[model samples]
Target: MVENKASAPGKGSLLQQTRLVCGLTLFTFVFFHFLNHALGNISLSAMNWGQDIRYVVSGKRLFPWIFYTAMILHSGLGLWKLAQRRTLKMPVWEATQIILALLIPYVLIKHIFVTRGAGELYGSNISYQHELTALWPNDALWQSALLIVVWSHGCIGLHYWLRIKRWYRRVQTPLLGVAITLPLLALTGWISAARRLELSGNQKLNVTAEQKSNLLEIVSQVQLGVYALIALVLLTLVTKYALGMFQQRISVTYLDQKTVKSVPGPTLLEISRMKGVPHMSICGGRARCSTCRTLILSGEASLSGPSKTEAQVLKRIGASANVRLACQIRPMTDIVVRPLMGHGKKMQAPGLSDRYRWGVEQPVVVMFIDLRGFTSLSEGKLPFDIVFILNRYVDGVVKTVNRNNGMVDKIMGDGVMALFAVESDMSSGARDALACIQAVSKELEKVNEDLAAHLAAPLRIAIGLHGGTAILGRIGLDGQSGVASGLTALGDVVNVASRLEGVAKEENVLAAVSMDLITAAGITPAQNLTERSVAIRGRSGPISVICLDETAIVLADFKPAS
Candidate 1:
């Protein structure tokens, strides 16, 4: 049996959480900055008032430290992530984000130095009036350009981050509406504010030649700092790659002895990329999605299990035992595995899709039908005849069940455990079950006549029906899904129905049904439906059941050889 267990909490999630928090912090700054820009729709003075409030929030001693720290850390981690990636080929949104992220530091460093760094480092009070005079006449084109670049990058990041959530799709339309409207408002306000400043003639040109040179020096230094950061990241990556080439390259054996060699500790996905293998990863190996799950064909005890983050992703898709995600796992030992979901296949949760549900209590009409005298009839027949007779009986039973909107859950030897109301309510389940028996009644009349020579006697069947709540789900040892998964109902309802069928065989009745089914179906029992109290096995007391006599629904009267 394959066992899929939920992994322990708080494993291998710190980096992801850190990135998310830092990203949100940076996104928040851009959002509020745009809002401050939007305040220009009222007036330039209003925009300055809003900008002052922004300053109160972010220009304070602690806030500036935090803001800059978040920016630098976020940028550094992003560069590190980019450097660590095995493949540049990815989804369009991911590629777009990476490109925009690279552009942000390059374009925004100059502005950051002037607006935030100038005030702190050089005692330049870069207030709204000072900034507006500088931006409107000096660098209005660059300011507008940076606004578009920053807003697009921020919006894409926010959308991608939130889209993974289940509720994201529910409100995606309205959320997209707000995403579009905010940036438009911001741009409109920025243009309006710049226009007002450009038109006003009373602008004080406060900065001297020395101060301007100092500002130019600061911007150049900031640009150099950005270049230095990128150079450091690239150099580190090259060094790591150079070291990795010599660092004990180990080949992990996959199915058919296909080997992908890489550093011993990187993920299987990393190795696959190193070997140019097309492994499926919808979320670009972030472990945010489980498109890269693999089933371990061997090395269960030898391989280390999944971390909590990998386990959590596996758990959501109902993955079974021996299945591990390729993204989060860093294999140390050579192991054999096969990918669960392949490239170009529409991926969902691997182990179980939405085809069936289980472990829930729901009322259902369970009908057990057993064919009697099969052994006696087939005693002198050839093996093929016996198999053919059994198949005919099963076929007839299945046809009748389907015609009545019932499902044949399982076949046990000469008996079939059929379920009713799988797609309907309890009352409809009872109605369907009744119609099934009547359908079987008519089917038996033709089957016995058709196979009369193969039989020593007529076919006899006892059907039992009971309706109540049962715990239903798919159970199986096969995790590939539905191959061995069997629909089962484990409750007193199924047990009582089985016992009732036994009573039917003993008392020579055509069918037996509990009072519960009769009342639920709103069927009035006929004169032939006699009430009886039968002591059932495993139950404390005798239960009231209605039995239909064989004479009322005898079915078979023809014989081919007679």
Candidate 2:
């Protein structure tokens, strides 16, 4: 099939985008709701202003449907995701919030149904006063549950958004304190109003005919709304599943080693859409799911930091520095980032070995080994057979190196370089070198055993061990630095080890050694050898070289490499 080069907008990509947009809209509604509720304790007039604001909001014909649609999509997608997962292993508070969210439609159904439906039916608009009066004496347990869940969900989303910023950590405690305290204040006010009403005799008085009719009207409207949401929710469920099936996509980035892709004039959501990558913005691209997260490894200047929604979500997730929601960033220049977790192929976890595992300031031991006769062996075998043999040989060598606290660096045509103590706290380079040599010898025996049935002759490996001070930093081109730069050793020690490996191959010995500097630093070779003066390639005159005896294999014939 001819690949379609023209990148069209993907299926259900718009649904994901709509979900994000709606989620953001909902978050905005949440902010507005709380801000209005917060106004109540200050003054009744301030609370009345909330009615005016609601009037303006309701005046927009699109507002109600937009919000309702968002609620359905958000709830439906969340339900599907929850169902798909094997376990809901979230924190306790988070789990509670999820339960609360599940209960919200029921809790809220009464309010929306009664007020909006009654206003539409009886033509008697229910004002804030009418709504407030219902809860004046005290909120029901379910109402309180609604408030807690709604507020907690909003706060958790906000916290996750903020946690991505480096500065967010600094004020996280204070922010959390405020988030917790304000909700308590809202609940307290509701309880106080409820207590005062409970003490009053107004509710106990005989209800007028009009008031009784209004109450029935409100009750019936709520029932209607509940049925409506249930039907729409089911419709949404079927639609989401139907749409999701055709919405498969893959995301890609042209990020370099120290960068993430940045796009101009596009929200991260739009970019992902354009790039054909599958992402979740369950709250719409409103920074709620945080599934659209990316790490700005190198191009921070190119991208904007977290918006309010993103800021809040990051805090909840406790995301580290350098992380940001793609939806939040609008970079003018190119940036590179792996989507923290999403539908794109799991790109290899970058920088796990480079930046996080090893630092340059640490002391490390460097070892270089070249398998002698590897080139000649390759010449005699088929291309596939050569690869097979070389791979087995390299695998054995690398496993041994790793067992000794060394990371195998680049494996050349016939040689491999590795380092030890790069990640160690106590500088175990010398010990690591000793272990690597023994490992190589032991692994070689296994390789020989396996090769005995395949090849005409046994393969021999020559390893040169050296230890001392080195930068032990990642080294490569400007970009693509981490692919092979995990644990590099710089300084004279590395150079000497390479030279010594050459000497080992030339000397026809299983091992070759270095100068007194290495010996002084406590790097003992596997075998005893005579110190000989030899003219080195780069050095001035004859340099002292410790040569290990070729017969050292007899001493270590018992132990397996593993």
Candidate 3:
């Protein structure tokens, strides 16, 4: 079975944690800076007032050191990550983020040197007015692009980091609105402030020729130093790549007997991408999503033990000891493996909304309906006739479920499984399930009449309904061109519901509705209905259910309790 792991708290690597903290610190700084710039929507003095508060908060003694440290660490870690990447091929968002990040230092170094460097070295009091005037009409476009690039890169980082969180998915839409609005407002405020300064005829900063020359010389040196640092990082990566060619190579044999040889350092995922092999990595091999999990068929001893993060993910998915995240393990020896989730087809697009994709636990109403004696009815029938009748029955059931705000999860031969309340509350879901059962009975009557000549006897269906918390998610591989095959619910609730259908069939009743579902739906059981506690298979205890032979009696008479 393919296992999709949910996010869980794990003992993360120190490097990962440190990078996260540093990135958050830098993002915080940028957030406040944007807010300060947004003050330009008011007056020039308002922007200055905001800047003064910023100075007290982040521009002061220790705060400045913290900010600078975070900036350096964040940049260094980013470069380190780039150098560590075994293959450059990645999702568009990941690639875009890296490219934007690379551009940041180049675009931002001059601005930083001109503002903070000037203030520290020459005691220059640079305000919004001074900066806006210096940048407007000439360098404004570059600065605007800089704002967008920095904000986009930061937002992308935050997205990947936080998208694993369940709550983050719920609020991402509004957060997206804010993400887009803030930078635009900052730019508008900046233009407004700049225009105000232009009108006032005060665009130049007071500075001596020597100070100007000295600042320019320092800025040029800093820019060249940044360029040199970037070139050095590239050289290091190229050197590593060149050296890897001469290193002892290890082979990975896939289940299809396709073998790929790679240097010992790169993870299985990196190897797959390098060799143009399709692999699933929904979280971009970050170990947050376990789609890239593989079962070690042999040579497990040659692979390293799972990292804390990998262990946490594997445990969450309830994977066996042999299962490991392909993105995390770098095998030192030849190994044969089978990817748990099928290759490229299973890889969900990164940053895809999790509303219906990711597994989430919620209260749901599950219903299972199976046609009684379907095998007996089809015994003497031709294949075409059997298919025609089955399709008619399934079509009717599907329509009935849809009309009652329920989703038909699956159909296996003559059985139909459906879920309710996936997009609604539990109460409504329970009501929908009950209503669906009632409608299905009537719909089945029409099917019986339509195929009476072909039927041995009028068709009869047994239905079971139960309500509980279950994991709801889209399962099964994608169809052609990445169309979802189906959404399904998993857990004890679904199992119980299926078992209850068997009870209904054995008791010869139209439906067996669990008391849990009845109570949740606020429906009062009818006096004539059969009430009993039946032990479900695979479960220890008996569950109370109300069985009804006639759908009209209870369905029409019962009213939902307020």
Candidate 4:
């Protein structure tokens, strides 16, 4: 028997929320630090002015506690997450983030101790002037490296956190520009300040040998502590794996009937990764995306219920009772499940709801447009010329479709697939499609006139329009924020439409529109066009269609159904 669980309303897991808040707080500090460094490009006084303002804000009694708390919590949580991973096999960006994060303490500890630690412990007044003098010519490389590593790690974290959001995609390009430019300016400013300090006599920080030695000792100890903590996490993971080897293993059966056995501790996603199975985890198993959700077919009693965070995500996506996040579920007994989303497939638009993004059967008008004789026309032309002509032709078709309220679903070489009424009723979509065909004819005329010198003859195209129920949904990379994915219609209707376009090409007519579309649009064929029952490839029965020649197409009339 399948156990059904109800979804609960919640925000997210407490650990994830805490990690995000702390990460944002630390990122704010790093952003300002880079800005302060950038001030050195103007002059040493400017850098000092900026640092003074920074100190005024961050040095407040309450602010330091917030800052230090955020720093500690953020770092600690990062380590905890790393320790939780069942497998280190991950994307390059994830690996890069981990490597850079580990390097941060080693590169930053001495700087932090010499500056903030020295100020607190030894009453040392360290200024940008002293810093520049000390860092130039010898320690500059490490300081620059520190700047890059810290900034990159912060940006990567922020990017992954925000990339799932729709609004973030709109501003990602500008944000990326800022991310790149700000660090470069800061590095330039640091070098500029250092060069200025070198021109003048190098000013050393006023510190006694004993104070310096004490700070160095503290830095060393802190570094050693970081190493120890990392080693402990690694050892714990190794120990856990060794013990798991002795534990009873459980079986997970996929939709393909392939079964894999693993220890009960790891999540289903981790098990897939461990066994070299392909699984989608767009948010890197952070419980941030619903792409990794699966439908449990059996042995539901073996799996625990969804956590609050998991339930929240499931509710947001409107998953059924048997659906569970693969990244969150750990099955203790043998179970059969199927991943809902395909691995490496793009998800629907970010703005769309799960029902629409994933899929829904709906009535839609599918149209296919293919250019005629374009391949032969391009046989002798230069590649550049061929591309130019194709672009102009495609531009005309796309514009006409959009003008008539149609969605250009896919553009293949010299062919185009469009859908109408995806958001409206079938009748309205059919009307729009009918109007689009006329508009496309007129637009192609204009395109031909414009490219008259480039073409041997006037450009021609064949169109097929069919309206019926098709599965409408978005497909593409999950969490791509709508950049690389789009809505599409799939079913027999689409296939029939494509085949009808071929019929038009074979018959040397302007279009072969299905009677289904004409009736849906409430239009009567004004011209006496021959009606034919053509058997579409891959379809069982013959479809009734009217082939419209160029003259008959220009004379076609449309009227709305009452």
- Kindly list the per-residue Cα lDDT of model 4 for residues 426-463, writing each as its tens digit: 77788888878878988999999999999889999999
Error of 4 at 163 (Å): 1.7
Write one digit per residue (lDDT tens) for candidate 2, span 45-98.
565587578759766356777788888887666665444322233334446756
Which has the higher TM-score value, candidate number 3 or candidate number 4?
Answer: 3
Q: Which ten residues in a row have the lowest lDDT in candidate 2?
A: 1-10
Ranking by TM-score, best first? 3, 4, 1, 2
Which residue ranges in model 4 land beyond 4 Å of their true spot?
1-11, 56-61, 343-397, 400-407, 410-473, 476-486, 489-562
Clashes of each: 1, 36, 0, 3
Q: Which residue pairs show collisions in model 3?
A: none
Pairs of residues at least 3 apart in sequence or in different chains that clash in candidate 1 = 358-473
Q: Taking the tens digit of each residue's C-alpha lDDT, what string does model 1 give over 121-146?
A: 66777666666766675677778778
RMSD of 2: 18.8
Give candidate 2's error at residue 346 in angstroms.
Answer: 21
Q: Per-residue lDDT tens digits of candidate 3, residues 409-509?
A: 99899999999877676777888888887788889899999999989799999998899878777776454465665789999999889989999899999
When 1 and 2 are scored with lDDT, the better candidate is 1
Ordered by lDDT, highest first, the candidates read: 3, 4, 1, 2
Candidate that scores best on TM-score: 3
Superposition TM-score, candidate 1 onto the true structure: 0.57
* lDDT, candidates in the order shown: 0.72, 0.59, 0.81, 0.81
